[model samples]
Target: MMDVWKRLLARWAGGSLGGGWGVVLAAGVGVFVPGPEAAAQIVNVQALFDEATAPMGFSGTADLSLDWRTGSTNLIATRLLASAQLRTPPHTVLVVARGEYNFARDELLVSRFLEHVRYRYRLLPWLAVEAFAQHELDAFRRLRARALVGAGPRFTLFSQEEASLVFGVALMGEYEQLRRDGEVDAGQERLDPRLSSYMLGRVKLAQNMSLVETLYVQPRLTSVRDLRILNETLLVVTPNARFTFSMGFIAAYDAEPPATVSRLDTQLRTSLGVKF
Candidate 1:
């Protein structure tokens, strides 16, 4: 049973964290958007916690992605993600941070930064209690800042060499500040209580290849209609122990978004990750 837990932690270490693909195609539009903009509120923090590169002690990973094009429209996009974890007996700690910038034809299109910290206590081989806090900002989304904190229990439905599934639910308290633009009561400070839930699954396709899927749903406790959803599917290819490559697709939706913000967003991205 201890060996199984070790295997599960090791598998989580391979998962990638925040940021999006450099080339973005807006949903419902066949053409690529001029800028690689995305919603930063829904990041894959679970990836940072799941990957266990080492059975004990501390481990870290860094991933960088860039897209640059020159010609009719000069464009540059860059993203960086870093994560570290410490494991000690029944207690584990994890931290992850990410930054992104995009420029097109000398104009800034996207800029965002995010930081997250999580702590977990393993009460059993198949169950853990977790608490987390996160802070994020996005220039494209006109978000000045957003912060949230939550705690809950997580259940490992199944775990094996070939596949795994996990589910979790939490009560989250959130606050946000948005930038105003000529709208009445725009940029107002807001606070809300939300129910956050997620499901994560992984499947090994081959000796060096695997697939991961994650889904997140957060609904306002006061009004279920005010909901947010995020989904990501990734195909990861590992050539060796230290390096990994992955291609992924992501989609996010907010039933009630801030003024001037779109309710839905999508992205297609590829990234190279290094673990140590």
Candidate 2:
């Protein structure tokens, strides 16, 4: 069992994700929308969602960042994220949405949007089941849209107030549409089945600080060479019950991407979060 686990981990590491995909996406989307314009739109949408919602066993956090600079070079960058979780008895639900836009010298450098929703039901102390759906769009990558839906089992490795670890495996179906670009075929689309697996861990680092790490792997059922991996690490500092400062690093890799796109994308973000 130990050797089997080691082999699995080695295989995962061998397919580690890369980070140049974002640069490619940014370059591709630069011509369609100006950076400042896109940033404004994201900010407006975030503001609209900031209004309070009636309680329904729901609690969440929201973050917004905006910056503008004026000089020989003018720059604007904005990001907004909102996530909510609902817990009722043995059932739990989570939803997240985020967008980012960046502009430098009046040109759009990056524009992307992502959303995910998940539902889980605890069937036993150590076992649960979950279903999830996700959507993504990145103008820079010339990804018109991608959608995924899946259901799977989640197993608890450890559970405690200050620390926890979990692993999940799911069978998913994905549909993707690609925009016509010089490099990618115009109106490209694919529908495929994939196997998805993930490990998640949370630990308390200090009295008011905590850490979370998650690693996800997805490989096309019909093509093992077509794989994707995502890893995210977050550090959160809570000064009080109502507010938090969080920094996160994300890395994503694709074994086979669109002709024009790179295989890896990476992002780092820091934001102030308010809890309701």
Candidate 3:
């Protein structure tokens, strides 16, 4: 009986002691030990992969609402759009970043740029036309001498959705001197073929979508140039009216080669577009 009592007391003591040690060990690990996979991480997954896209349209969003962010969609254009606010005697400048589509590329370049700043008369209520000659750079690359001249009428489509619809046509001549980087061509510059009579049709899509279709006839390759044309059908989405994320096909329909550049060919490009 004494032996049995001794055994019971010893077992109880051992169990309590064991539990105490376990509690201490667990506390130590929970307080001081590092996590399992700390060393392998190089870049912050949030920063590297977070969808904080750049701003698109030209006119800036108001300071307060600018804080909200979107997770799904992207900004494809940002521009400083100027519409007429003829409150005073003469309708004056209203600075708003208007989202717009790029010329040759179906992407939106910037919201509103000073295409040509000049003194002109605001002739009609919603219609204004002008002509100007300016040096044309790819606008994105501000390089390669391409001169653009002539102008067309810009009319306001004042619908319920805030003049969101605009249609215009422009006629311009282009001299395209296609040049490659020095490392690739080794300082050899060729007189790249020129494209004349570049025609443009600017079509307004949804609230944040606009489509610009450009048709340019290749100058030199009489057959390919005669037959060669580049048309990009683009879809632009405005996440919060400040930025745009764009993706689309370069050639919607390309004839077989003998001619270069195809139809619905992503061979040219497929990537993210951001405007700042």
Clashing pairs in 2: 18-264, 25-140, 25-141
lDDT of 2 by residue, 1-276 (tens): 434323322332223212223222322222111000010011111111211122447788888765442321235658888888787747766677888788866677766777666666779888987666555666766767665555777888887768878887777655566677776476676666677777777788998997878777777788888878777787878898788887777666777777655576555657787888
lDDT of 2 at 165: 82
**Relative to the unseen true structure, what is the Cα RMSD of model 2?**
13.4
Model 3 spans with C-alpha error above 4 angstroms = 1-122, 132-144, 155-166, 176-230, 252-276
Model 3 poorest 10 in a row by lDDT: 34-43
lDDT of 3: 0.28
Which model, 2 or 3, shows the larger lDDT?
2
How far is 11's C-alpha from truth in model 3 (Å)?
99
Give the winner by TM-score. Answer: 1
TM-score: the better of candidates 2 and 3: 2
Candidate 3 versus the native: TM-score? 0.33
Tens digits of per-residue lDDT, candidate 3, 1-276, equal 434323322332234434223322332222211000000000001111101121222222221111111111123333233322112222221222122333334643431122221111235655644332222222222223322233444444442322233333333222222224443322222222222223334445776665544443333333343333445444545665445554544432223221121222221222233333
Candidate 1 error regions (>4 Å): 1-40, 51-54, 66-76
lDDT per residue, candidate 1, 44-125, as tens digits? 7775567333558888889886644222223566789998988887888777888988876677766778767777788888
- TM-score for each predicted model, relative to the true structure: 0.80, 0.73, 0.33
